[model samples]
Target: MRCFMLHIACLCIASSLCAIGDDIDEAMRKSVPPQLKFLRVYGGDDESMPPIALTSRPTNLRRPNIPFNFSHVTIELDIQSPTPPQMFVVFSHCNADWSEHDNSFLNDPALLRTSSIDWRIAPPASVWYSYTGTLKIPNEHVKFNFGGNWKAKFYLYDDPQIPIAIAHFFVVDPRVETRLEVSGDFYSPRNTVYSSGAYTIDANVRSVDGMNDGQLNTAVFYRLNRYEEPFIVSDISSYEDVNQRTHAYPLQTMLAGFGMTGRRFRIERIPAENEYRVLNLADYSLFPRSNAPLRMLTPDLWRNGSFFEKSDGGFMNTRFIATGDRDYIQLEFLLNTQLIQAEREVFVSGSFNNWKPDPSWLMKWDEETKLYRLRQWVPRGRHSYLYMTGEVDADNRKAIRLTSEEFEGNTARAGHTFIGLIYYREFGMGGFDSIVGVAGGSVYGSW
Candidate 1:
């Protein structure tokens, strides 16, 4: 029975493997349920909301590009209900395009590792529970000797087939170095508030492996910090061979600039003390192990991308220490806004929500109080957040998508991190795009 299942898994990858578009999307939606959310696989400490606090990190950024490292990667999930369920995580190696590699199951029959997870009951303030699973890649049992994309699927430990959650991660043996520089309008000097942010990238791509030169088709992808999607330069410009070992693909593209005027006259900055207001329902704080409604938190203004360092009562640079004693803390977020125009929605986005506009973070306007309110149950720690309002796409099923710079005003002083990725598709490879190299840097506008 085990051999039959192995053969089936191999066949699925070899044929339907790495298939994108509708097939892959449908498969992912069917495999993972929606209620099991905020699934992440990160390295270092697992206690932080975002294990890696880099805002410029890729949405798909799961693991550092180092392969066969000793660092442990942890997977975590939040179930909306307090009931603890029997969960198991299964790890699999996949090609760059995220399909099961053909040789994965055949060569290493033990390529798939399954481990059970114990769910911890969250604090009384939270309506949900948290489940954490950790795995050290290249440990005694599993060694990811190769570089590529990988996946971890969570399922019932007893059934082990119905996937409840899924996460995609990357393991890279970086054979190349990608250096990027931004030249134009690094600082917003022209305007006091609305800076017409125009910039281009100066890139130097070097490959240690001689085979990765201008001879192959290479592309560069870049994005501003906190944005969900990236802009792609499909056909890079000025592709030249600088030397035998290095290739220069100098490229630049326009970035979206922020506007000066909006519903809120100017970007409001709240006092440092009030930022990331903490709610302690523990035995010492207000409501202890009781269902009493906590006090209403004071409303805070837009932070303008200011992060709360772990030292300043924030979670940054610190790891979450699970005591199995603290209850969940519920904090209310408010945006002072009169009447939101029609077809517009407000969201509070940050590293906590992967910097994306999730429905859970959407704030509803309270007419009586005249504030957009959101009650979120966050793990104990400080966090940074930004308020964003965008138009709801009526034609596209009323999808709420944010526009660059309009809602989240980007100032010259606002720190922005840009990550440059270079993907190389060698001649005659029917497989996925291998991330040859990656480079990232932070830029602040100078007026």
Candidate 2:
């Protein structure tokens, strides 16, 4: 009788544990927002670019305003509920490395947070999302007084402490002159074929206000349309380097040179990867609106050393569809790997996800078909993407070091834009790092 009673007790405990697990799963599901996107609008174009802007100021006699030079970004997202929830956006100023600034001069919380997002019902055909919300920065509700890396945190009005989504953008108040140069001369640790395509980038920054050279000791380089990750170079040494993994040079001594009011930052052996592959979904006749997921007409074949098809650097084009007609479609991507085998896990990176290789985009290898397949719901547009192979970093699971060179060949002729941002340490207002200049150049032409 005692044994039977103990067995009943074990069953009871098991049932309680299962109930707890269900509750936890439901909570996690509710915590995640359906979809959130931070987009920079260039005039009437809806294509994606780095969400960067110059600090706004009134026109003056000395510097007359230029036509079509306005810079601001919009935050768009979908809320799952039919009734719009009370959402708020809070802004914070960040250092060059993206760490939040603690000083009030750099970040004033009271003036930086707002709950004035415009919400509207999703299109009639949209099924996954119910309502859409949009908020533009530097609007009447909030303004960016300081320039640097900025973070926008979205939160529910009731639960102000926790953020449901976060977006990053940059505000630059150009106070220095900057120049960037790219050349096809560099050395790589890889073999001859890989080394042949390596390029070197040199960014020269000179202070216009006669600032000390030591104050202009930091700078960062980014490939256009790939703003989430940057190669940061700084002279400051700390016990723990925050950007050790993404540093342009392994050591500070590798910096090109320093002058009275000028600093040069150089990064060599950067692979000139071939132009991105294009996935055009703008033709409504070819890709009609449908309830079922649509598969590509042809499977993507593995390209090792071959290159074809010209493409936009890494931008998404959504201007073809009208504002009311814009919608998301479920896309099935298949990569044929019958000719070669993958040594590491494969993922699809594209402008849709800001070229981020998140685990959700991981392609599953099908043994029966010898293909890597991934089904994702992407907005209707033309997107540029690449197939990458890499593992997640052990130290930081969120940081993945994926490369496309193994599948996508590299060539110097492939035009790519490199943007350089000059960082200066301002000793005023308790001292904070700020972007004083911005410049960009392309290997084949001007960006």
TM-score of each: 0.61, 0.83
lDDT of each: 0.45, 0.70
Candidate 1 Cα deviation (angstroms), residue 106: 10
* 178 Cα displacement, candidate 2 (Å): 0.8
lDDT measured at residue 116 in model 1 versus the true structure, 0 to 100:
44
lDDT score of model 1? Answer: 0.45
In model 2, where do residues sit more than 4 Å from their true spots?
1-48, 57-69, 186-196, 237-253, 256-261, 394-399
lDDT value, candidate 2, whole model: 0.70
Which ranges of candidate 1 are over 4 A from the true structure? 1-37, 46-72, 80-84, 90-110, 116-127, 157-162, 182-202, 215-228, 236-296, 302-322, 338-343, 391-400, 404-407, 426-430, 444-447
